[model samples]
Structures are given as C-alpha cells and as structure tokens.
Target: MQDSPQQPGSTGPTGSTVTSVDDPWVPSALEQERAAYRSARTRRSALVATASTLAMLGAVVALVGSSPGWPRVKETFFSWGKAVDSFPAVLDGLWLNIRVMLVCAVLIAILGLTLAVMRTVRGPVAFPLRLFATAYVDLFRGLPLLLVLFLLGFGAPALQLSGVPNSALFWGGCALVLSYSAYVAEVFRAGIESVHPSQRAAARSLGLSYGQTLRHVVLPQAVRRVVPALMNDLVSLQKDSGLIAVLGVIDAIRAAQIETASDFNYTPYVVAGALFVCLTIPMARFTDWVARRQGFHGAGGHL
Candidate 1:
C-alpha cells in the first residue's frame, strides 16, 4: 500500500510539501545563512579575545621580568621558599578571617535590616527610632572602618566596663558590624524604597498591618533586589576581616607579618595577598553571577 498522504504540520519531502501549509516553522535560507554568520563571528571574536589577552599578559610578564630591579624584587616579594614556609600559617589564619567574616556578615545583615526598617517606619511614634537609626548610620558611615576598629578594639578594652568582654577580637568584630551595617542599611533602604509606594498601599488595602505587609511583601522584594550588593559587601568584609590583626589578633595578615619579620622578605605578605585575591575573586564573580541571574547589568560586561 502507498504511504498515507502527509498530514498538515507533518514532515515530508520539501519539494512535495507546501512549505507554509504542510511543514512546521523552519529557518529560511537567509535566516540559516545569518545564523551561520553569527556563529562564525562569535568564534572569531572569542579567538581574537583569547589571543589579545595572552599577548597582553605575556608582555606584562616579560616587562616585569626584564626590569633592572626584578632580581631583588623577586627575592623580596616572590621567594618560593618563603611562600612555601608561610603557606600553612597563612592558611590557618585565613580560616580565622573566614569565620570572622561569616559571623560579622550575619550580624551586619540583621542590624542593617533593623536599621533600615526603623528608618522607614511611618509614624510620629517611631520618630525616636528613626532619629536614632539616622544618627547611627550617619556616624558610622562617616567614620573610617579602621578608626572605628581601633577605637573599639583598643578603647573598649581600656574602658574595663562591667559585664564587658575586653577581647580585641570581640571588639574588632563589633566595629566591623557597626561600620558595615551602616552601609548595608543604606543599601537595604534603597531596596526597600525601590519597592514603589504602591506596593505598601496595596498590601495595606488587603487589611495587612504595616509589619505584616513589610514582612510578607516589601521585605522579600527588597532583600532580593539587594542581594548582589550584599554579596559585594560580604566580599569587602572578607578582605577587611584581616584588619582585626591590628588589635593584636593573629589573623592572616598578622601571620604573614610575623613570617616576614624573620628576614624582612615581603613574600609572606604576597602570599597573604594572593590568598585574599583567590577568595575575593570567587565572591566577586558570584556577585556578578547573581546580578546576571536577576537581570541586572553589572559594570564588568553584561554580568
């Protein structure tokens, strides 16, 4: 028996099929050519980019290696022996930095959200809270983080107040929370305000109390919108966690410093810096990924 006639939308010989009526949508020859062109162009662009990047990096390496001071610089800053010796100590200390960053990040998010809510709450009754939050944000944001760390890390212990833990690490972490929270609060506030006044109005119209509306609607959106910013802050927090070393804490930087003091070789510091870069870069890339996932265009390309 002969094959049944081709049904509409079924596959058939192109010569026998009515292209428009008998077949599903297919790329026209022009469209096919355009797609091929695009693919070739993308490959060519990638190849050019790879070559250019390798060339630029090679030039930088050659330039640096050929400099007159390269030998001394290498011995001082890039000694392989020093790096190997310091790696374990620096790695151990970096674990401390990571823990401090994680702890401070949690506290910062909580305190920052609280401050943002306080500043945004609507009512005469909340005037005092708003004032306090505003003053706190302004004061902390204006102060340099290092100065705040010094004041808290040193002066707080000097106070010797009742029921106070005078540990440098404790106070240094507190200073980090206080300073970073101010900045994070502003980021949160921006996210909160970006939610559009209509969202609050709509939630209230649904008989939701201000707190409920904020918790159910405004906050979720606000937090989602600010995630990329928050991640960036965490990245900074990871690096700055090293500053706790100033308070006599034996963090990564301090460990490197100790290792360097033996021969005044800066290699340990370089090792510490390389470790920080390794950690920070992934966080930075993750932030960009988050931005892209959320349809945000970051400064570095299309995120």
Candidate 2:
C-alpha cells in the first residue's frame, strides 16, 4: 500500500528539515562559543589549582624535612628551664621597647608632618625648605638603620653633640624616629594629594586662604583616607626596631642574644621571638581593624 501523503509543514523530501531550526541538538554559534569558552576555562582552572597545590605541598615538605635547624628549635621550646629563668630579662627588655617605640612615634609624627608640609608648599620663598625636607627624607631613608644608629651613637661624641646619649636606649629611639619619619612623610604627602582638587577650588571660590582650605576641608578627608596605611606603616616600624640591636640596645632580641652568649643555648632567642610576636600582634590586629573600619579601601584609595 502507498504511504499516506505527507502533511503540510512535516519533514519530507519537499520540506527539507532545516537542521539549524528543526534539530534541538544543533546549537547557535554564540551558544557554542560560550560553551567552549566555559569548558576551556574550567580545564585551565583545574590545571592551575592542581599545580598550586603541588607547589605548596612541596614547599611544606622542604621546610619541615630538609631544614636542620627546626628540630633544635623545637627541642629548645620543649625545655622550660632556659626560657623560664630568662623571663625577667625579657620582661625588662619589653619595657624598654615600649618606651622606645612611644618616644620614636611622637618624634616621627612631628618631623614627618613638618617635612610633608614643606615638600608640598608652593612658591620660590619655600624652595630651600622643600630642598631641605627632600634631602633629609632621601638621606635617612637610604641609609641602613644600623649605620644611622652607629653614627648617632659613636660619631656624635666626636662632634661634641650629645643628641644620642651613651645609653643604647637613646640611640635606638632616635634612629627609629629618623628612619620612620621619612616613610611617614611620604604617607602624609599621599594623604594630602588624595583630597579632591575641586575641594581646593571650591575653597578658593569662597575666598578662603590656601592654608585655611587645607586645614579645614582637605586635610580632614585625606587623613581619614590614609589612616589604614598609617597603621600598617606603624606596624612595620615596630618590627624594624629589632635592627636597634646593633646599637647594643638590650631590646628583646639583644637581651636574648646576651643570654644565648652566656649559656650557649638558643632558647632565649626563641623566647625573644615569642615576645616579638606578642608586641607585634596588637599592631597587626589594629591594622586589620582600621582597614575594616575604613571600608577595606586601597591605600589612599588609589586602588
């Protein structure tokens, strides 16, 4: 029997099935491209993740197994006698550290504020001020902290200058102020620049003086923007205080070194490490808190 005539719009020889339209299996060019892109991305991501994992594992193994010193460090920690008896010296050193940090922070703020303002000032009248500030910042920032301390300590006596006393405490504190002020000056400058230029324009339009505008409008906002970064820099400054040991400052590390020298045991150094962590942890936490409070913006909002 002859087959029934094909219905209108049905798939038959006269009505060729347009594969692009009729076949659900066929995909559009754009959709196919997107699918291929997704597949490639997923495969690439997998490969990268696997490689990273392997690298991390290798690093961990190398750090734990290949290093010869970690066992001795661990053993030192296990022995309580050496660390326990040196606790008094460590506490005294920590006290000195607190005093040094406090004094240096104050000096840095004063000096850095002066330098930052000088550098940003306008006109030929302030040319020497700008140059002086620039030279001071560049010189102190370039020199190593230990060398700076040595000059301030040993060289000062020859010059009949008593800025840094015979006490290492005096020299270490001065060194910190000198070194960190340069860095903080840069921070302050960035903060000042971050203020919108229009604010100054608006202030000028209102017949405000340059100083007045900066003091009232610009500086307030800029300081808020830079608080988080300032906190980070302060934390870094605290860690670098360890370099003061070169000046014979009996800071935590230096005290530990003395104890190590006397007893031939490395336990005191471990204690010093722990003390450094104790001192630094608060600063670290403060930085995190400040950053969060500032809405996690980039340093000076440049991000």
Candidate 3:
C-alpha cells in the first residue's frame, strides 16, 4: 500500500495542520528593514570590539617591551629555550594537579552536600547536627586555606600516629577537602533553601517521605540551580591544587620550583603558570557557557 500525500490545505509550510500554505505571510518592508538594521548593528559592534581589543593588547605589548628591564625580564622569565626544556616536566607535574583537583572535587561535593543537608535538617532531635555543621562551616570558612594546609601537612606528619599515613600529600588533600567543602556547603545550602517551601509540601502531599522528597524532588532542583557555582568552585580547585606544592608534593609549581633552582631562571615558573592558564581558561569558559545555557542570563530566556 502507498502512503497518502499531505494535502496543501491540511498542513501549512510551518507544519501546522490547522492551516494551508496557499496564502503565506510575508515580512513587511519595515520588518525587513529592522532585520537588516539588526544584522548591520551586530556587525558594527563586533568590528569595534575587535579593533579596541587589538589596540589595547598592542599598547600593553609596546609598554612591556619598552621597559628598562625588558631584556633581562624576557631572558629570565620568557626564554623560549627554557620554556621548551621545562615543558615536559611541567606538563607531567600538572597531571598531579589535575588528579588532585578531580579527587578533591568529588570529595568536596560529597562532604559539602552532606553538610548542607545536615544544616538544613528539622526538629530538636537534629539540633546537634545543625550546630556541628554551623561550627564546622564557620571555622573553616574563616581560616585561610594555606594555614590549614600547613597545619595538616606539617603538623599531622609530626604527630606520627601509627595507623594514620603521615604523607604530606595525604594531609594536603585532606586540608583541601576540608577547606573547600565549607564554601561548597554554603553554595549547596543556598541552592537548597532557594527552593520554594511549596515544593516540599507538594511532594509530601503526594505521600513522599521527607528523605524521599529531598532525594527526588528538592535535590534535583537544588543541584541544577547551583551547578554554575559548583563549577566555579571546581575551577578554583584546579588552580589551588598547586598550593599542595608548598607541602612538598612535587605538583606543577613544585616541579617548577625545582627547575628554577637548577639555574635560577624563572622561565620554568612562567611555563608552569602558562600550563595552568591552559587548564583553567577552558574550564572557566565552560562554566560561563553552562551559566548562559541555564538561562540565568537574558540570553537563555529563563530556562
């Protein structure tokens, strides 16, 4: 059997079955002019932006090049030969930073979410949990991350407990997880509380328990709401992972330090920095893209 043809009056060109394409709507001259004007305006704005950016960059380059210590600065910090020599080692060390960031990110998310839930729990019975969460957040959020790293990385190893590993790397990671989780817990809590109370009531009305409502209804929305914030924290984690180097972990910055010690040239440090920029810029852009796509911006239209 052959399929029937689509009648012209049955389906319009726009694919609406209620109308025919026999009389198609056309843009008026005013609408056509408006569209052309918009296109031209966009092109002009882009051109101006490009020219201004290039001019600003050129000015900065000229200023730097004309500095009194330009040659010395260039030789010490931007030598192509040194960069080439350090690239492999720096890249290898950066892998450690990446791994640390990945592991710490996962641990941060888990601990942070747990803390958020703990803080948000109801009832007098859960007051202890709320107090503990509040105290933990206040303590860590007030302390500088570097100090925490120093205390844990140096002090933990000094204690020499039999069952515990005293490695600086382990303690450094613990410090990172502890410090970062506090900030991330606030982000999670903000997201969770931003959720309207009506949602919980609705879920409960449908016979869901509090835990079921949180897991299925509240959390999904909360997590989605704070995704950009979480991603920003992850980006911060990537850069801050280098701080583990101060604990003697041989991460990218530490490797750069050792390389710099060989000849006192800072080019290896610059190389390490460039590699981190390479790592961070993409993630930063991706976070912005996620933010835009989520419709927080006017561009995404309240998605």
Give the candidate number with the greatest lDDT: 3
Q: Per-residue alpha-carbon lDDT of model 3 for 118-146, expressed as tens digits? A: 99999999999999999999999999999
Worst 10 residues of 3 by lDDT: 294-303
* Candidate 3 stretches greater than 4 Å from native: 1-20, 23-25, 296-303
How should the candidates be ordered by lDDT, best one leading?
Answer: 3, 1, 2
Question: Of the candidates shown, which would achieve the greatest TM-score relative to the real structure?
Answer: 1
> Please, what are the lDDT tens digits per residue for candidate 1 over residues 1-303?
898776654667765543455456788899999999999999999999999999999999999999999999999999999999999999999999999999999999999999999999988999999999999999998999999998898788888899989998899999999999999999999989888789899999999998999999999988888889999999999999999999989999999999999999999999999999999999999998998887644223343
Scored against the true structure, residue 266 in model 1 reaches a CA lDDT of: 95
> Local error of candidate 1 at 175, Å?
0.7
- Decoy 3 TM-score against native: 0.89
Q: TM-scores of all models?
A: 0.90, 0.72, 0.89
> Candidate 2, residues 100-197: lDDT per residue as tens digits?
77778778888887788889888999999999999999998899887888888666556655553566667667778988999889888888887778
Please state every model's RMSD to the true fold in angstroms.
4.4, 9.5, 5.9
Per-model clash counts, in order, read 0, 0, 0
lDDT of all predictions: 0.92, 0.81, 0.93
